[model samples]
Target: MQSLFFKIFLWFCVIVVLVGVSIETSSILANYYETRWQGVLHTIMPMEAEKCARMYETSGKQAVQNYLDDLQRQKSVRFYFFDEDGNPLLDRSAPEVVQKMALNKEGLNRIAQQNLSAVNPRQGIAMRLVPGPSGRKYNLAFQQSPTLIMPVSEAVGTHPYYRLLGIGLFGALLCFLLTRNITKPIVRLRSAASEIAAGRLKTRVAPSVRRRYDEIGALGRDFDLMAEQIEALVAAQRDLLGDVSHELRSPLARLIVALGLLRQASPEEAPEYLSRIGQEADRLDKLIGQLLTLTRIESGVESTQREKFDLTNLVQEVAADGDFEARAHAREVRVVSADACTMSGAPEILRSAIENVVRNAIRHTPAETAVELTLKQTDDPKKPGALLRVRDHGSGVPERLLSDIFVPFHRVEGGAAGNSQGAGLGLAIAERIVRMHNGSIRARNAPDGGLIVEMELPTSWA
Candidate 1:
């Protein structure tokens, strides 16, 4: 019973077997009460019946009844004696079918002419006519042995239990099929779960399970989805650890070298050594700060509260900041085209992202050139949003490396990883923050020269 297959199989088997037995019993009983008479046994039946009649004539009705009773017990045969007019000769009750054959002389003659005695009690009954003490005819009816003709007027088969055995085999087959249909999918799912628990993050349910159009299919699909997300998060985490350690090692080594130089240097050289140490410490701090920001945004810990603000104003403000910083490098930041567009997002977070892009452009633009910005709203049916473009008039990033710019610690070999350049985390942080606001960002080489970064974002109305 503890096994579901056994429980279901046994219960179904029992119910089916019971139903089969009931139907068989009902069929046998129906045949039992049937009025149709079976032909004579041609064995001890009519002969014994003649003895019953002679015994009745010699010893009277009671003694004949006793003799007949003894035969009934030993032979499983019932004897009925009738006079020539269809009246009972013995003090015993007979079935109505027997009485009917006796009363209908024509029907009785038709059967008797053929030397056969017709009787009821299901099959196996027989009848015969004999002379009585008064020199008149007598009809004697006796049933055949029930064991030979049992359960119906039809004769018994060679084997008594064949029907029951067939029914049992059919029930077992049905139960086996039913249990297999239900438990097969469950077994697959359990195996998948076990594999996953053993650190096989890529483990998935079989296609057979997933293709099923039922709740189990839905569960299988959801399980695969969860595994996919878990794998992605784990890989990202592992990469982050490796990148952080690699980035930290460089600055630490430099700081250690600077500390050694400072302690051994003369008074005049000490300040320079100390300053070098300070710069490495500051760079290390900035790198760590950007890492924290990226982690927060990626981990969904950063607040995403939204507010409506003018995109034009935010762009102009960022340009002014970049321009002020650029002035020292003989460069300028300017807004080329501006359209007043309102958008919804965490304003400070978006400000950081936009500022990062603008400053990166300013740092890359040539000393005599200007970094250009444009802001406008689009009404495309597929994506109604505002598109902001920032262009830097310097050597653009390599086309092959454009997509890599947003990855943490990614830097173009000869374009932006110079000794004086900032750590390559500004664009990475920008990408994460922009993604948090449900915006898309990408970079491409400008037509004439330099590089253009475009950000498409939904406006408040959109």
Candidate 2:
């Protein structure tokens, strides 16, 4: 997997697993040998003790000591041989852990007891009795599991090349942590980016990264915000696509049903089915046209041919036309103030944007309620722009769902105008066109009663 955490974890696991398995295997084998040697000592210690007796009588203490020394090295068992009176056969010291099995009558001093307190104790001392050649008894006491620790070279791969590599890695890791405190966050961001690129829209930078006050942290926060917007857009697009399919299916299905009825009908009923078929065809055409307009606006195709035009003139023209259309339905569209301001963009597309908003308001406003339009140049230096406000006398959108009105095919299901008569691409197209022109569109409820749709267009364009 292309996972940073997985990669790092795998690396650490490999090193630990290697070291652990090696040490564990060595220890297991060493323990097995230690056990076998302990068993063999039982069968042979007495024989060796008797041999020591003969060696001391004939050869000398030196020869017996040499013999025991060889056995200690070969069998890896520590020995402490003594006579019946408790004198060591060899001229060598033993660990205090095993000294209790063979001690002098005078016993150990207080200093020795305290000094040896820190010494680790073995399980027990293995003792064997043997008959001397001169008929005296001698005691052989030894400890099990004499150290089987391997040399550092063999145990740790301390060959020249490996040693250099290990040192280099250690130094690099130290330098990396010291010099690149930001790398981890960058890596996390890269990982998050990769995750999103792979279609995991919800993937986000780790919260630890976001909590930092540095640039990397800011980047993480921005990255997460971008991810959220992208996820929302993708979800909205998916929903729009599904809605488009469903919308298309309804009209196509109605057309099919109408055609079937027309085929089975007598001449008298054919006219009704033909009219119904024509109505379905017109619905499909309008939906498809609206879908195409939305696509063009979102893709910036409609606004490609920028031209200087008077927004005041554009607003008045749309108002007059909307007024004429609305009056037929007992509603009216009127301009409150058409401020004389000019801007560069596609006037026809901008015209479409204004028309859509006015039409929506007209559709929702009660009979005889005027859909009011306001246009003015804003004085805010940071955002010098032209603002348009369209207010309608109707039930406002729910506070929580005000922003959703501009989403394709999303309608505010309130009041008389909440029907699904439209494909719901009108405000969505207008929203995109305004954004492409480096402007913004937003809707909020007026304080009195009704919804206000605001559009802000920048004066200058790049």
Candidate 3:
């Protein structure tokens, strides 16, 4: 009773059975009455009575008796005869009730009025008269025993009760199958939901169920989407905790060492130790700030503050600042090309994202090398977006590790740019910000031997 499948199946069965029984009961009663009455009237039709009367006179009493007996055995009817003077022709005794009936003027007239057919208490009798060659009148009576009506022995087809049983069985089977089809998808959704509740976040309903074009199908698809979101959120939370722990350990350790040095150092060396401690504190503060920014972006707490602005100018400003900083290391940051692309977004957030990439490029490229920036309007009519590419002439990332470069705290190991120290939240935060703007970001090795980062934002944001 608790199972949805069983409940639907049983309810369908009850409805089918009730309807089938009602139909069969009414049909059987109607058929039985219609067939019985029609056959009863046919048996004692006036034409049949006349034919039997003629035979009785021509074939004589004995032969007529034999014919009547055959009719009685086949059609369940019997015959009685009397002379015109009211004398019995064949002395076969009939029941007293039939004798009384034949002698009564009212009963006889009633039978004649109906063409010699009449219904008594239990049976129907039909009678007729015929004339001999000498014009002598003879009276004839047809009677049935046990009941007045004759039963039709040769009725066609199976009995009505059996037919009803067959119809009920077929309806029950159809209902059972229909219920299974209706509830199968629900059963699968239930199982998947149970698994998910039991901590199996990856569980999902079958794809076929989701493809069904119905309300249940829509529910299944929506459930899968919810589960995916939950899984992503859980993973991001774990990654954030791990990233914070790893990134804080180095700065904290430097602070501890600086503190020990301050305790023993003379005044001349004390300032340097204090400065080192202050720098470590600054690094820790910066790391915490980056972590908070990443958390806000990843968790969607920081809603997009969109406004119209020129993305080209944003890129130029970031590149210009990077160029000023790169001069200290004999490196250059240059805007190779620019396009006039007006956009809508949180300008400050985009500025930070773009500036991080530009500075990182300048920080990693070899002294005397240049970091190149390009901005262009995408031509695709459907997308109508802007693209920004940042490339550095440093050694390109390893092919296998390129995919992991944007992961928070990820650093390229033993590459030409590996000498620089970074907490590695820049690209990760940049990617999140790009996605928030309904954009995409990716990194690849340039053909001329460097790393290239491309970012695209659609025109809807413009």
lDDT of 1 at 446: 83
Give lDDT: candidate 1, residue 366.
84
lDDT of 2 at 269: 100
Candidate 1: the clashing residue pairs are 124-144
- How far off is residue 275 in model 2, in Å? 1.4
lDDT of each: 0.76, 0.76, 0.75
Candidate 1 deviant stretches above 4 angstroms: 1-183, 381-383, 416-420
Better of 2 and 3 by TM-score: 3
Candidate 1 or 3, higher TM-score? 3
**TM-score, every prediction:** 0.65, 0.58, 0.68
* Candidate 3: residue pairs that collide: 122-148, 123-147, 123-148, 124-148
Per TM-score, the best of the predicted structures is 3
* Model 2 TM-score, 2 decimals: 0.58
Over the stretch 295-349, how does candidate 3's per-residue lDDT look in tens digits?
7887676655678888888889998889899999999999999888787887888
In lDDT terms, how accurate is model 3?
0.75
User: If ranked by TM-score, best first, what sequence of candidates would result?
Assistant: 3, 1, 2
